[model samples]
Target: MNAVAVIEAAVPASPREEWLNRGKNLGAERRDVDWRLADWLSEGKAAGHLDQAGFDFLADNLGIGPAKLKLIHKAAAIPTHLRDTSLTVEHHAHVAELPVQEQIELLTEAKRQHWSDDDLRKQTITRKVETGRAAMLSQEEWDDLSRMQFLHVWNRASVAAREDIAELVSQSHMRCIDA
Candidate 1:
């Protein structure tokens, strides 16, 4: 076939292919908006432009939940250069407390692999363990030692403290079940 014929015979991009690329572009835009909002939030709070009442008003006006606002606030710690436009705000939040170099490395790998937020979170935890910043309990250790550790703490508590802890543990158990 002639070059023109060969070119004409090639298939156009499929809808799925187009949508996948669009998703990446959309994610990048979303990341930029989130980063800008986070910066504004951090600056406003620090500059006395936003207090609790002001935050309440803003949250009400913007329809942003306290939890999401907290996450955005936490995300403000991440530097702009380390941000990957192809990742979500949550991805940045997960690595916000990490060192700048770690953030760059993690975000770069995440963008290249198209990792989900949960996948990124797991990877971050693993990185923390590797760097000795955190520890992970093995399944066997959790099964065998968790109850003993709880009992050890529980036994030394005052009656009032025990009651408080009981309430907290009850709430924690409910949260775990809901999760």
Candidate 2:
């Protein structure tokens, strides 16, 4: 449920972190969301994967802060054609054909690549299912996602000493010493 079931509560960005909120300065400009992120979400919807609640969670937690996120809550609640299971995407396919696992896989890969959902859907519609075959995701996408090299490993490590940290990032904003 990336964009279908949820609307995140965005907090406003402060001076130092303002760059990530899409827009924070010059007024009016801030209301618009990042188009690419929105697109990824829309694709998630078309694929029958994105729900409103999940999308809200991601936007609130990762993409924007609380105050600003909350501001867009109402606008994000609007329903779209993709939300109905009875309706076919592009006007075809049974409701059963839209597999949840496939949708989830598609969303995950798109997130990994930072792709808008619409981009993925267009690719699917124009290429994957258009070649006179049964409806299915592109084989290239499936193979790419399934490959071992595509795997990403994440683990946390511990560290000590503030000075050590500053030394490590001496050239960064977190630098301890005022060089």
Distance (Å) between predicted and true CA of 96, model 2?
A: 10
The residue-by-residue lDDT of candidate 2 on 40-130, one tens digit each, is: 5556667876565766676766866433333233223223423322211211111113444544454445546655444554444434344
Every model: Cα RMSD to truth? 10.1, 20.4
lDDT of 1 by residue, 1-179 (tens): 65654455778889999999899888778777888889999999899988778777888888988757767777888777766666777888878768888888998899889898767766776686668876443453244345655777899989999998777768895465232
Candidate 2 off by > 4 Å: 1-16, 19-97, 126-179
Residue 172 local lDDT, model 2: 72
What is the lDDT of every predicted structure here?
A: 0.76, 0.42
Clash pairs for candidate 1: none
Residue 69, candidate 2: C-alpha displacement in angstroms: 20
Q: How does residue 64 of candidate 2 score in lDDT?
A: 68
